[model samples]
Target: MTDSTAPRVAIVTGASGGIGRAVAERLAADGVRVVAHYSGNADAAAEVVAAITAGEGEAIAVGGDVADEAAMAALFDAAEQRFGGVDVLVHTAGIMPLGPIAELDLETFDRIQRVNVRGTFVVDQLAARRMRSGGAIINFSTSVTRLQMPTYGAYAASKGAVEAMTLILARELRGRDITVNAVAPGPTATPLFFAGKPQEVVDRIASLNPMERLGTPEDIAEVAAFLAGPGRWVNGQVLYANGGAA
Candidate 1:
């Protein structure tokens, strides 16, 4: 069991941007030491670390491909070396290149699986091995899996595998007192969500939900903060943070 008084350590993968950045900042704000992991954006990762430090929060930037086992293992090492031990793992690292199932190229599908599926597996494996007993593992999924939207088949499929892993891992950690869950965000207002999307398409998707506006990275971060801290009982499930889109 972790010492409740000690600051918890968290590794937020993909912390350079989007929901990952929000989650990293939020956790740090809540007094958790953060390992901000980025795959290719060292400058952006530094910016994340800077913002956290500027806010009087503890954070460090680490760069690695999430699918690479050796790199991810080193990330855990750094967190342990810097913050004592890890207590939370928010795995928001993933890629979403939209294409219709029938027309999508095989290369794109493979890339999605490599980053979204295998990347998740590698990170979660390390977390399971290294996290303290009273920790949590939060994986990123998407409401697209439930929305049945066209052109989202490949991305949704990758997240479906994530959902499966989240459930089984929760059960697998029965005696460890750690919680595992996935957060499925819908139509979030992130650079990734806006890329290649026309205003009309974006408006149409936003309107599908009752809120009429798109979800923000902070909105998803709120749910992540809950799971990472007080929401201990919400295990083995995928909480849809989509503003009732599905």
Candidate 2:
């Protein structure tokens, strides 16, 4: 059994890049030993671990598909074998394919829901079963769920499900002492956000927020870190880290 005084262990999904990478590093800096989960990019995940190690932090890179139950079970087993127990789960692994609801093909919409909604449910279920008391489960949602953007139908729907699951899971945990919450980021400037978008479109989305600029990966990571650590009173809610984008 893990000692109460031992450092907390966190499993950060999608830690290979973007907001996930930043969250892994930030949590490690806060003295949480990290299991950096990657979907496919092993090298990028390794880089994140190396950076954390260089800063004298503890971390490991584990690769698995978020939507696969067996694969995710293996990931949890790996973390338990290495770090004793998991105290936090920052699930940032998801896909975003943009298109109008009517125009978007059924196949693509299904893929988005599979990765985003199903993925969140799978990991959150595993975390609920395994995480220790005082643990936090932070799932990723998007501000577009409220902004109601044109090309975000599929993505928004998936995230809307995420938000709903997060809230109810917190209540279900009841006496478990784990806090469940979703971070809804708006217009974050990551490679994922830059994909398939022109400069003009990017600028317009960026300007939708009062900050008048694209949010960095670090910006979103800060919110995840809070929910993981000191934000104990914040439970069963979606915290918008969008600089007033709503």
Candidate 3:
């Protein structure tokens, strides 16, 4: 058991880049020891860990497929062995493949669901069973579920499953003092969002938000930090971190 006075520990999946990287850095800045989980980018993951260490914060990189049950279990074990125990799990590991449901290939749809839906279940299940009390589990969703934009059918469906699972898991952990929630971001300026899009299309989407700009990974990271720290009263909610888009 972790001493009450000890700093909290967190496992941030997909921490190799984008929102996950931002979240891991932010949490470490806030004095939380972080287990940075990456899928395949060892170099990128190591860079994140180096930055954290240079800043005098604690972090380690762990790589694995988020949907793999054994891998996820080992992730949890590593956090426990390294930092005493996990108090927060920010599951930012997912893929976004856009396609219309009518024409989307089954292979693509399956891959998206595997990473987004099954991945959430695998990681969250481990967190729920292993984390100390006062834990916070933040999953990722997308505002596309609300926007219902064309070509986002498969991605939105996967996130919808995420939102549903988040709510149910929160209730199921009743009285555990653990908060379960999801963060749904819209039109973020990440590499993932810019892929295959022209500048004009990107500009159009950015203008749709009331903020009149794309959300930075840091913007979304702020929400994750809050949920993992002082936002204990907030539970079973999907906090949309978009700049008022949708």
Report the number of the highest-lDDT candidate.
1
Q: Taking the tens digit of each residue's C-alpha lDDT, what string does model 1 give over 27-57? A: 9999999999999999999999999999999
Lowest-scoring 10 consecutive residues by lDDT in candidate 2? 1-10
Residue 29 of model 2 has an lDDT of: 92
- Candidate 2 per-residue lDDT, tens place, 1-246, comes to 447789999999999979999999999999999999998899999999999999999999999989999999999999999988899999999998888888999999999999999999999999999999989999999999899989899999999999999999999999998999999999898999999899999989889988899999999998999999999999999999999988
**Cα-based TM-score, every candidate:** 0.99, 0.98, 0.99
State the C-alpha lDDT per candidate.
0.95, 0.94, 0.95
Segments in model 2 whose C-alpha atoms lie over 4 Å from true places: none
Candidate 3: tens digits of C-alpha lDDT, residues 1-246: 457799999999999979999999999999999999999999999999999999999999999999999999999889988888999999999999887789999999999999999999999999889989989999999999998899999999999999999999999999899999999999898999999999999999999888999999999999999999999999999999888887
Output the lDDT of residue 62, model 1. Answer: 93
Colliding pairs, model 2: none
Cα lDDT of candidate 1 equals 0.95
Model 1, residue pairs in steric clash: none
